[model samples]
Each structure stands twice: as C-alpha cells, then as structure tokens.
Target: MKIKMKKFGVLLFAFLGLVSCSDDDDANVDPPFEGQSKSYDLTEVGESGVSGTATFDENEDGSVTITLDLDGTSEGVMHPAHIHFNSAAEGGEIALSLEPVDGDTGISETTVEMLDDKETEISFEDLMDFDGYINVHASADDLETLVAQTDIGGNALTGESVSYDLAEVDVEGVSGTATFYERENGETLVELDLEGTTEGNSHPAHIHMGSVEDAPGDIAITLTSVDGASGMSFTNVAMTDGTDDEEGTAVSYEDLIAYDGYINVHASADNLATLAAQGNIGANATEE
Candidate 1:
C-alpha cells in the first residue's frame, strides 16, 4: 500500500511540472502586435507646393514620433501640420497638433503622447487603432487651406479604387471612364479610357473646378493626353492649375470628398474649344 501511494504521488508531481512548463511557455509568447510603423504619401493641395511623406514610428517607451519631410515649399514660410481624427476623405477634426513644418526646409519632427484636445493620452498602439490622417496647411495663418496631406495607419486606402463615367459632350458617340487609383506614393493616378473617338488624335483632358450642376469650371489639372490609337491616357497627377508651368496643385483626394469638380475631354489638341466628353468627378460627381 505504501509503494502504491508513493507511485501516485510521483505521477501527480510530474503532471504539476508539466502544467508549470506549459504556463511558462504561454507567458513567453509574444503579443500579436508589439510595435508598428507606417509611412504615408503626402500629395499637393491647392496652390501650395507642399508635398512629402509622414512616417510614424512606435517607440519602445510607448510614445510615437512623427517625421514630416516635404518639398516645393516657399523659403521662410511656416506650415501648420496636424494629425486629424479621421480619414482624409471624411475630413476629420484635429485630434493632435504636430510641430509646424518649415516651408523652406519642409521638415518637422514631433513626438506625441497626448492629443491636442488634451483629454486623451494617446500611445503608439492607440494611434494604430485610431482612424486618422495627416494634414499640412499652406501657412500658419491659413489653417483652413490644406496644401499637402495623406491618410495614416488604417485610414489609408489600400487596394481601393474610385471611378467616374464620362458622357458624350458636343461630340456624339464619344465617352470614357475616368478611374482614380489610390497609390502608395501619396499621388492618385488617373486613367482615361475612351471610346467612339477617332484614332491618331490626342485628346486633352482636365479636372475642372466645377460640377455639372454649375457647368464645368476652368482646367484644374492637365492630365496626360489620350493616345489617339489606344483611346487610353494615364497620368500620375498632382492637382494643378492646368498649366505646363505649374505642377502639383493643392487639390487632393480628400478635397474630392465634396469637391465640385468634373472631368472634361477636349475634341482635339487644336480644337480646344470643343468637348469630346465631360463628367462630374468626386463625391458630388456621378459615380459608377
């Protein structure tokens, strides 16, 4: 009977040792997310030459550092930068204020532990879960004017797309699709695919300043001319004033949320007065 009891005690001790070992292994397992870092492409907005990238890195201490780098800014100008509470498309409120970027050098380094509202203390992991974006204003005095920006973290458009169906205008049997690809470079690439048009003639396309409801405005961005033979035009565009002299306008994808903009395709390079096709763009524009 003593031998039997001793054997049972030994078995029990072995089982307990196994359980302890399992618990230790579980404790050593790393978390699903220990750290995170993301880079956002900032596009030109309005007339400001501001454009760059915002990189957010999570530190071991749980704080976040935002590094802003840009180009095409005027020397001696100060641009106000911020981290807003939502995606650029949604136009969110300011959640955190970053160090203002120098327009001349186009750089800003900001460390954040709390929000601009000051009611909330935000950590790097918190920012990863938060829906937010970065915005660079034209100047400190012109806070309302956004010159460059991009969505951050999960707010970014990954593998997403937007399109507009163009209609025949002035010229019958001429139409196309205006598709915008949200690229990682912080610039939207627009592809114009047209049909019912002649070959060997280049068609000038522009994103105008108005919608169909208000009649198309002047050229906002001059897109790459469509190939007469292929009926396709591809342009990696920064919003502009539709001039060769100017590039990368302050208009961005976020501005398209309520933008009164439209796409206009001219009949031919020489026939700039004639429209081959036209379509409203952005949230206010006709969507397919």
Candidate 2:
C-alpha cells in the first residue's frame, strides 16, 4: 500500500542560486552544516534500472537538506520511496514519496528543513530535530507492484534500528505467521510490519528501502526464512555508522543487497522462489 505525502508550502525559490553560496561567511565560522547534490546511475550498482540524482544539504538547525531528481520520470508513475525512521542493521519504511522530476530527465527537486538536535521531535512535525536519511525507490514491474528500491541520499540513522514481523500471512496459497522485533542497545529503531489485509500476496517478502518497490540499490539486504518457522521473531541487530552492516555481526541498515545482501523464497507456487514472495535480506542481520 502506498501512502501519499501531504504537500506543504513551496519555499525553495533561490535553491539553485544558493547552491554555490557558502552557509558561513566569517571565513572561519566553519559555516552551518552544508551539503551538495550527488548524481548517480542506478545501473552502475547492478541496478541497470534507471538514472536519478539526490541533493543533500545541512539544515539551519543541524539536520539535513534533501532534493530529489526523478531524472525524467513523471509523477503519477506510481513508484514508492521514503526516509526510514531509524538507522539500524535491520530495516525500515518509506517516510515519503519521491516527487518525479520534470523535463527530459524526469528530474524533480524539493527541500526539507531538518532539526538534528532532539529525538522526541521526530517526524516532520518540527523542522528542528528529525535527524534521518532520505531514501528513494524504483517502481518495479512486478505483480505486487512493489517499487523495487534504492537509497538515493541522506545518511540512515546508524544508531537507530527497527522491528521486523511476519506481520501477515495467507499469500500465494500459503498460511503462516512468523514475526520478531528486537533492537540492539543504542541502535536506530524504526518500526515496520506488514498490516493484515488484502494488500496482496507474493510481494518481494524481504527488506526493502523503507518503501515498497523492487527497484535497485534500495533492497537493503534480504531476510532469510528458517525451514518451517511459523510466526515472527525479533533480533537486536546492531548497526554502526548508520550504514549497512558495521555493528558486531548484524547487518547495517544501510547495506543494500547490491553490497552483499540476499533475497530468497519466491512467491510462485512452482519453485516457490519466484521474483515475488522472495525473501531478500539486505546486508547481514547480526544475532543479538
């Protein structure tokens, strides 16, 4: 299921002109946190999917500034993307959508004012304390229609993690419920679980880029299903540096399979490991 991000006020009028300006002027003030936009081709990372660019900047409050470039895709394209709440080795959710780009590249741009000072001020409610990374998703042409994914920008909260649950069962003629949620001490923790509903069976059952999709680069590691485990289980996988796999043995929340993750158990009735229903584990999941 896709969740639409509420459109707010448009205040980035001089973004382009300010790209070259310095956030600080006293020469030694070191300037407030500042960042730049980075361009990349999804194909370079075994994504062979498409092209896009993401811009990152330091907000006046210490958080981050983000701009997305659809590289030429259109809005109504129905791709999913988001900012995972935590930065753990486990996984997360799509906090928002990647507004499609305009012109030939389908490049779209937008900015966010962040506040990296407090944690209780999470969510985009206050523009002063939500310190999290910005991730993008690629629209996959799958039956589940999960946007195959990839992280385009921002730093995933390394200290934050998530809770994974086989929240739902009854898909592709299968019935089982296995879920587990555990977070490492001092690690990022973003809560994500499948809601019980006709959301559809045979989704790429694995860790996606905080969003639903089968694109590229965003498949943070794949989850493995033990022989006949029913129900869910939780693991306090540790994540260091908000990247994919840096903690003891747990997978880094930022490690996309492209870096050494896996997705298995397809959704097909035949091999039962078709592209869909496949449990793709992003990076590595360290044991608690």
Candidate 3:
C-alpha cells in the first residue's frame, strides 16, 4: 500500500508539470492580428477586357499588403503593374512597382512598406490620402499598353457628377454629351462621349465664357481633344489656361458647377468656325 501511494504521488507531480508547460507555451504564442483593408476597382482600358480590384491590407506591424486580382488575362503570361503619382486622366510618373500578376491565376500579392526609391516609407495610412493611380501593363515588353487601370485615394471619383447635352451644330448627326465628374480632391474630370464623328479625324473641344445663345465667347478653358475613332475625351480640370500677364486661374468642381459657360466641339483645329456640337452649361443649363 505504501509503494502504490508513492507511485500515485509521482504521477500527479508529472501531470502538474505538463499542465504548467502547456500554459507557458500558450503565453509565448502571439495573438492573431486585427487590421483593416481598403479596396479599389480597376477598370478595363481600351477594350482589353481585363478588370480587377486592388486591395490594400493593413498589417499590425505598420506595413501594407497589396493584392491584385484580375479577370480575362491570358494563360502563361505575366502582367506588370505599378502605382503612378497623379490622376489617371493626367498621366504621371511611376511611384511604386508592384508584383507581376500571373496570367494563369490572374492574381498577384506584394508586401510593401516603402516606395520604389526605398527611402520614402509609405504606410497604410499614407495610402488612404495618396494622390495617385494604378496601371497594370500587358507585359514588360509592352509597358505602354495598359490592361487595367484606376484612380485611387484622393483622385477617386466622388459619385457626384453633372452632364450637359451637346447638340449637333455644323454636322448633321455628330453630337454627344459632356460629363463633369467630381473628384475627392475637389477637382473635376471632363469626359466627352460623342457619336457620328469621322473615323480618322480629331475634334477640338473647349468651354467658352458665355452661353451658346449669346454667339461666340472667348475660350475660358481648354479641354482634351476628342478622338473620332473612339469618340471619347478625358480631361483633368484643375485651372484655367495661363496667359502672358498672369498665371492660370485655379478652378474647382464647386466653381465649375455654378459658372457661366458653354461647351463647343469643333470639327477640327483648323476649322474653328465649324462646330460639331454645342451646349449651354452651368447657370444657363435649361431644366428638362
């Protein structure tokens, strides 16, 4: 009976030692991280049919993980991507290089804590206010061809926009609409979508100082030329054209919405007298 009791005492001591070790191990293990994430949609560029979402995940260590998931990529081909410094409408330099997306899986993941220069540290918080855009290229050989792109951070669209009709003036059937989209940074993106334009010609567009009913007015703002092939034009409006005496006047989305102006799409740069489309905007816009 004495021997049996001693053996039982030894077993109990071993069991207690095991429990203590288990507790120690549990204390040493790190806890799961709880962080936030942001996602931005990348739209298809030039009928590439490749579109995706760029997701930025904030890590507990103050780093960021960027993931790109695209659709319609060709199998076995890799696509290069990067973050550019300005709005997509206003092209800019590459700010950060990203991982190449695998065409077969159409996915890419990269962990970054710094810009391409390595000296500029960009945290997840900094990305929230970044004035930049993303571009995914077709490949290393064709970097100029963008498969997918988007305006992120401060350059993103605010979902508030105004559109004005562009009636045919000189041309019988050439007409379209001009839309002004508000940006998060208070700027505006002017997009012109037209139909019945000549296939190979380029049309000059502008916003004049007065209404179309008041005859012609001085050009208040110069916009991007409309491409006849695609019948689309994208312009970033930040200021008015600068003259010899003074600098360009600063313009914002708010100022544009209440300004007195008119839009004209000319047939060509040489033929300024001929109008492809004309419309009254701002205060002169007719309620319909």
Candidate 4:
C-alpha cells in the first residue's frame, strides 16, 4: 500500500504541474509532494531489468531518471536497450535509450532532464503530458519490458496550465522526433525535431490508432507532409475522412483511440520502413 501510495503521489504531482487545482479553497487538498530523488532496483521481468528511478525535483531543472541494471547472461555482446513509448500490453518502438552495459550484468541510465538537452532532447513537460513511461527492450530479440510508468508533474515558471514539450526538428543526417504538443482553439500545432535525420526524399508519417503499450487496431491519423534530413518539417495533416481522399490516407479521432497507435516518423533516405523517433500523441485529462 505504501508503494502504491507513493507512486500515486508522483502521479498527482505530475497532474499538478500540468494544470492548477480547483478554486474551492476549502476543498481537500492532497499533501504537496516533497520533491526528492529515489532509486528503484529493477528485476528480471522478461529479459531485461524491471526497475529504475523517477526523480521529482523541487527545482525546475530537475528531471526523471530511469536506470536499467541489465543482466549480461547473454554471451559476450553489447545488448540494445531503449526507452520506448506505449504500454507493455501493446508494444511500440523506441523513443529513447539507456546507457547500455554489456557482458552479463550491466547498468544503463536514461536521465530525462526536465528542462535541458540531455539524453533524447525531450522535456519533462512533454513526457508528463502523455502519461508516459519507460520501456526496456531485449538486446537481440523483439521482446520488451515496461519498466517505468507515470505522468509529468511540477510547478515551473511558465504559469501555464499545460503539460508537454514542443521542439523544432533538428536532425541533420540521422534520427529525429516530430510531434504536436497541443491544440490551441482548434488550429492544430506541431513541431518537427530532426537531430539525426538522414538527408533524402520525404517519408510518410502516421498517427496510428492505440496507445504505445497496446496493440494498434488501425491507422487513424495521417500527416500532410514528409521530412528531410535537413531538419525541415511540414504540418496541416487532415484528421478527418474526406471525399476523393486517397485510400489508406486520411483518418479521424474515433479511429485514433480505437486501437493502440502512436506518431510514427518513417526513415526514407536509409532503412525503407524503419522508424526514427516515435512517441505517443496525448495523454489523459489531468486538470481537476
């Protein structure tokens, strides 16, 4: 019960950071979370570690760190592990990576800075917005483990009641992340972050159905542009069905949540169908 309570408190803190509390002063207010850094010892859930740390700093620059103590049970080799988006129930692709430890027992760390450019250049604000979590994948196989799960929380200087991060596409010749943080008054807004995008022809992007941790039922969302390796991106994706719409092209909101899907940015210059930086769209309503 205590562990559950503590985890709940963290989730609440994330909620608070996203939006302000209700106006009723007399209303019962949950105790303010005392920001602190804590460590978690992961276990062998499937083929990787099952634990890490979710640090909530009182200072605005604090970020949540996920450390994986991997088992080097495999013969001499550097196993691949990444922090992916989605639930363990429905698997998704890799979003970030933990410092890999080779051999038998190794420790990989993924410290997601709340307000800095660290591991994946992702912000705590953005991560918290998706009800996000950490996923550690098997080195050689497709099997994976949902290591950490929680929402973003905190009180920053922004005075805004929104939880999410939006950055520009900056990949010059490799992988990158393209996302839309929120929709303001109906005009859809998104950002294309290319930090390692390969230079070549544009590739197709999609907002497939379902959450990261669940199986996708269908492709519900589509993008209106393709990305280049020069950190260039475009938007204005049609989210609804239309007449003369290309087959398997456009989708809708109902289709968005029906199946577990996410924002898939495909790589064109290199691997034909390979993904670059993929993440979930939006989380749940956190405001009270």
Residue-level lDDT of model 4, residues 1-288, one tens digit each, is: 999999999999988865655545436766656554433233344334343433422324555665555443354644455545543223346566556545455555566652222444455445544322344445455434333332122111122222222222223244445444322222233445556545665766666566545734355655643556455454433244334656444433233323244566665536535655555655521223
Tens digits of per-residue lDDT, candidate 2, 65-104, equal: 4555554344555344455553322345544444533435
Q: Which should have the higher TM-score, number 1 or number 2?
A: 1
Question: What's the CA error at residue 280 for candidate 1, in Å?
Answer: 14
Lowest-scoring 10 consecutive residues by lDDT in candidate 2?
Answer: 1-10
Number of the predicted model whose lDDT against the real structure is largest: 3
In the range 1-288, model 1's lDDT, one tens digit per residue, is 999999999999999999999999999998765667877789987566668899888877878999899988878988889888756654678889999888778899998888987778898767766777888987877888988987776556556568888899898888988888664445566779999877878899888787877764776777888877778887655466645565555655556545678888998889988998888888666433
> Candidate 3's residue-wise lDDT over 61-152, tens digit each?
89999999999999989999999998998899999999999999999999999999889999888988899999999999999899999998
**Local distance difference test, candidate 1:** 0.79
- Of 1 and 2, the candidate ranking higher by lDDT: 1
TM-score of each: 0.50, 0.32, 0.87, 0.31
Better of 2 and 4 by TM-score: 2
User: If ranked by lDDT, best first, what sequence of candidates would result?
Assistant: 3, 1, 4, 2
Root-mean-square deviation per candidate: 12.3, 21.0, 5.6, 20.7
Each prediction's Cα lDDT score?
0.79, 0.36, 0.93, 0.45
Query: How far out, in Å, is residue 193 in model 1?
Result: 12
Model 1 poorest 10 in a row by lDDT: 249-258
| lDDT for predicted candidate 2 compared with the true structure | 0.36
Number of backbone-clashing residue pairs for each candidate, in the order shown = 4, 72, 0, 35
TM-score of 2: 0.32
